[model samples]
Target: MRLRLRRFRPRTGPHEHRVVQPLHPLRHASLRDPDPIGHLLADHDGLNRLAGLFSFAAYSRHTVVHIPLRDGVPPDEGMGELVDLVLVHHSYGLRPSQWPGLRRRLTHGTPLTVRTDEARTARDAAAWQARAHRADRRDELRHTTHARTFFLFGSRDVFAEAADSFAYAAGNGPLHKRVQQGDLALVSAIPGLRQPPGGGHPFEVLICFKPYPPYAHFKRPGR
Candidate 1:
């Protein structure tokens, strides 16, 4: 039998990258911690205040967040909040099902873990030019390194302060829908960021708050 080589599909395009799925068995096991969502709700008073402001229209770093009508706020009133959690680096959309996993990790103060395929290698600059479409993607395949990072957010003002420089995976659909429904929306920051800068060794951490299905397939890094 003749073997056919499978074509590589880049993680791009509007709907192509949207792989929102449920937690894998192993990831589900990690969520055994006691009521993590409740803990977060109890902890952040600032989050509680601005939790209602979730819907926004973004262009570049500028976003106009619309406050819901529940607080008797004017329907025409659009509150401005900065967004820093745009999932640009990776193209996959955020999965609502993974919220529990994220909650578990946050409650335990554990960094989100990711395992990439070791077989795939990063394309060189010349190679990247050949595949010009993936211009936003960083890191070489062979150089895939593990990152230990946690999520962070303060007041809704902070969220409204900076136009997030990152991109979101869900394009602009469910992300807006979930927030409108009053679902818990959050952004995770790279780990060790809370400490003063220049205090720890320099490490590159990804910013996009994309929670993938447990054990998602990754191409082995190429040499």
Candidate 2:
């Protein structure tokens, strides 16, 4: 199925801060379309399609996906750009049912209370670190000598800032620090939407400059 792109502008209000309930597992599964990962792994065409979506969101400044905090409250404004990019990158892995709600939250605004506490935040940060390590290991095994490094961030502001830094470093940095041609400086932001090893997040962002040959396919018109 072709993925449709839409602009999202979330609304926020003081009284909208109530926690939204989670959906039942079977019901949730029923709402999702077939996993796009299968298509992505199938060939470069699939990968390029995904890259197109990313370019669209980045250039258009559209928040195509929304990942609420654990309590269903939207992430702060500091997370706007990074959050949109991260979620769009991972949208192929999300359920269709989840998309509607996420989009609604983004468009309608879910100002309901921010339920995160210090302990929860710390735990989430640690979990994010562990996930980043795993991603590092995977890259190492896949690329061997060419494996890229993972940069982890706990704060939303820093994570958002790193997006720009990565872009600059990827294209114009010194040889040792720059991302090589055909590779991408990518960001992985986890919302902990799935269960166990996958779900629950301190909503951390992890950036890496890694091999991605399809990078040339989705460049903006003039650039």
Which of the numbered candidates is closest to the native, going by highest TM-score? 2
How does candidate 2 fare on TM-score? Answer: 0.23
TM-score of each: 0.18, 0.23
Give a tens-digit lDDT track for model 2, residues 121-188: 33433444456445442211000000111111123222222233333333332132233343333333
Best by lDDT: 2
Per-candidate RMSD, Å: 20.8, 16.3
Give a tens-digit lDDT track for model 1, residues 132-222.
Answer: 3455633221111011112232222222221221212122212432333333233432221222346554333232221222213311123
TM-score, candidate number 1: 0.18
Candidate 1 yields a Cα-based lDDT of: 0.22
Global lDDT of each model? 0.22, 0.27
Error of 2 at 183 (Å): 7.6
